[model samples]
Target: MKFDVVIGNPPYNKGMDLDFVDLGYKISNKYTVMITPAKWQTTADDYSGCASKNINYKQFREMYVPHMSYVCFYPQSMEVFDIYQIDGNYREY
Candidate 1:
């Protein structure tokens, strides 16, 4: 499914990696709003979406809060790509 805007809270907490959920929302490149931990900033390198050295990505904006969740806005253009996580989950990022 294609979309211009995406807004929602994916499954968070309970040992969920917010980055995975963020990447899952790759279907919406123009804009995305998600309430999640700010931990995703440090995991940018871990995302397969950054595999290409030439890909330019804008830093995600979020209100930094550890224990408390923060809403994040990622208004960046990304080339849709696919990868198979070792856990057998297929994702498009």
Candidate 2:
């Protein structure tokens, strides 16, 4: 079995590994989009920088990692974010 398009609204919370989201891209033939939790909230990474209580957008963007080629909110101050198709993938499709 194969898929031309794969879409998912994955369950997310603190300390959740997003490896499954990567699977969506691996299986899809064309496109895959994952709507993850807002960057403002603290995630598993615990990377220092984002001070959400102060409404620090710059810090949030700076701390965001393991994602590139993504569609991000401009002047992104507490906005919804999603990762787009990256140049290379974790696995061949």
Candidate 3:
């Protein structure tokens, strides 16, 4: 099946967020929207302590960024969701 839009709030663990975004973009014909941690925007080397370190962020950025129409960020202090905070050593990511 094909879709015109793909939207999701994927888990923020182990770089799964980017995986979702990638899949979304692949399947969607018009738009792919994801609610994920903002860490993927930074250099992969910055994720040395987490699974995201393995992601080639440079390639991801080059491929996806140009196609993105809009992007948003919320401050760390702001609670975007009412759910409990994720537990991990790399909370920032």
Highest TM-score: give the candidate number: 3
lDDT of candidate 3 over 1-93, digit per residue (tens): 769989998877767677778888889989888987777787564444444443456656878889988988875524665444445333332
Candidate 3 Cα outliers beyond 4 Å, as residue runs:
45-55, 77-79, 83-93
Question: lDDT per model, in order?
Answer: 0.43, 0.46, 0.70
- Worst 10-residue lDDT window for candidate 1 reads 55-64
Best-fitting candidate, scored by lDDT: 3
Steric clash count of candidate 3: 0
Give lDDT tens digits, candidate 2, residues 1-93.
557876776554321324435566668777667665454344334454432343243333453343435655443322333433233122222
Each candidate: RMSD to true structure?
Answer: 12.6, 13.8, 4.4
Residue 26 C-alpha lDDT in model 1: 66
Model 2: lDDT of residue 36: 52
Shift of residue 80 alpha carbon in model 3, Å: 2.2
Clashing pairs in 2: none
Candidate 2 vs 3: which has more TM-score = 3
Structural RMSD, model 2:
13.8
- Candidate 3 local Cα displacement, residue 66, angstroms: 0.7
- Give the range of the ten consecutive residues with the poorest summed lDDT in model 2: 84-93
Please estimate how well model 1 matches the true structure, expressed as its whole-model Cα lDDT: 0.43
